[model samples]
Target: MICFMKNNLIVSIQLPLLILFFCSCSLLNADEGKEFISIFDGKTLKGWRKAPKTSYEPWSVNDGVIRGEGKENRLVYLVYSEDENLKNFELKFRYKMVTKGNTGVEVRTRIDKTGKRPFEGYHADLGHVGIGPGVLGAWDFHFGSGTRKEFPCQRGTRLVIDSEGNGKHSPIKDAINITEIKKRDWNDCCIVAKGNFFQLWINDKLSSEFTDHISEGRLESGFIGLQLHDKGMVVKFKDLFLKKL
Candidate 1:
């Protein structure tokens, strides 16, 4: 009878420890699976470079945030210079647009001195559009020298871009929830690019996606940049992270 009682006590003790061990192992595996690298230190722009004509006063690091304020006559970009080129990767960051203006992130783009726009590449657009703020999450292609300078795909669109820089968009039944995006508040933005596939997520909701089949005009690889569009605008970005697949 004493042995039976002792065995019961041991089993009760071992069961919780075993359960905890398994839970810890599962958590360790999950953390190991996600190999995200921090691109921004949140205190300084150590691995970033601004466009030639851009002023430093408008771009400053304040309280662990990359803050952009004031005005510029033209668009300017703070390009990531630490990495050579990003081809197949997932980039994520938190951004807040305080002013009623435009801001975006450029991917697979390069600096074009002759181009009219600040960055010549693909842009994940954020901010207001038209009379309403419906087009906060969208995608745009800014070709440096093409006849079609800009090609846009709106939120909840599954688009296809051809080699001639022409785009065809189809509505994605129920992908986006616009109400989830907090205007003038900190929002999450994620971009995934793999080969010809590209996707954008805002506030953990799928906003837009596209496939590029443009053999001649498609960009395979280029630098990543943060854009400040229009004058008298303020935008803050933080928690910039990237994972290469």
Candidate 2:
């Protein structure tokens, strides 16, 4: 009888400890993602600027959103001019391809104060998937001398850029779900960068992944920019948030 009572007591004690252990694990998992801070005020372009030597006519803020238009049929950039030069971070924003041509987010980018192109760095490419190919859901590389390497990792693909700046790519099935994205409507976009690894998510689905080992061209830290590419493109962005990883 005494042994039975002791066994019951032990079971009761062990049960609570197990429950506590599980609860702690749950809390840790919940906190795994880093915290983000608002980078856009939604009312004004307070912390952003047009790339130097570029026209500001393409960008505006209205109704708590940033809008860009490719009225001139030329490349332009609205760059994040704040002090933070991010090396490893996650950027979250909502984008709407209003009258789509080509639009994208630029990260780890160096702004050209007086060059022909707006910046040099990696591009998280986006556009109306209806536009197709190079313009739609891809990763792009830019150089300072008005050169572009388009679609290193197109939608539903993975890419690796070797030390010699050569890219090897492979398709990733279901990485981008076209049916899940709303056309002519707002969509959630996320770009995560850690070391040389990068990921692009559209509507919460992984769209592309890239690993950069291009010692000659890869950038470790730089500004962020929103791109307005080619003619007749209209894009809107809001809820710009950044989480340093």
Candidate 3:
């Protein structure tokens, strides 16, 4: 009887130890991923500029949030820039909608003082609904303005850039799949842009995968912006951290 009790204790202890070892290994494997950078400092818009606005209201960084209040069907943008060049880096941020509307992170797009509608650019094309058709994962030739009648060109399609970072868009990346994260709740988004390929991870789950080739523009590196749709739209972002992998 004594020997049997001792054997049972050994088995219990060994099982717990084995469980712990496997858990540690899982965490280590997760850490071994590509590099990334966090554009938001959660303090101020240090690397951003309040670009030309189409409305009187503007985008601002306050207490670590990049926020916008939409107006006139034009939610302007606050853009970012860096003196150094960047390539093949992932960016992560948390976005929460104060109220449901349209918004998305803008990448590889540019604007001038005239607020000339994302001059020569691409927008992520995000709304409350997720459809695998647009610049990021879906397509609708949605020009700068909204329209009931569709254009001759397709909308909701992703863009393509060359090695020099200049290119036009095509349907090479077929469709984008997004994780249906909860609205008004803090959800993490990861964007990986490498040459003509980009991938998106939502809430730590692989969502959209994009690979395209275009020759209209180059995307070696460019400003990042957060946009809100028309007026009364508000979204909050926080705890944005990135490590270049």
Best by lDDT: 2
Best model number under TM-score: 1
- The lDDT ranking, best first, is 2, 1, 3
lDDT per residue, candidate 3, 16-100, as tens digits? 6434422321231234564334567767778766555564745666876767767656656666665224455455666777775
lDDT for 75 (candidate 3): 50
Instruction: For candidate 2, report its TM-score.
Output: 0.79
Error of 3 at 187 (Å): 0.8
Kindly report which residue pairs in candidate 1 clash with one another: 163-214
TM value for model 1: 0.80
lDDT of 3: 0.51
Winner by lDDT between candidate 3 and candidate 1: 1
lDDT tens digits by residue: candidate 1, 144-230: 664344556778888997777677878877676767878778887788888898888876567888888877757788989888887
Candidate 2 lDDT, tens digit per residue, 121-228?
788988885866455667877766634344357778899877766789888776767777779998877787888988888775778888888665567889898998
Which pairs of residues have clashing backbones in candidate 2?
none
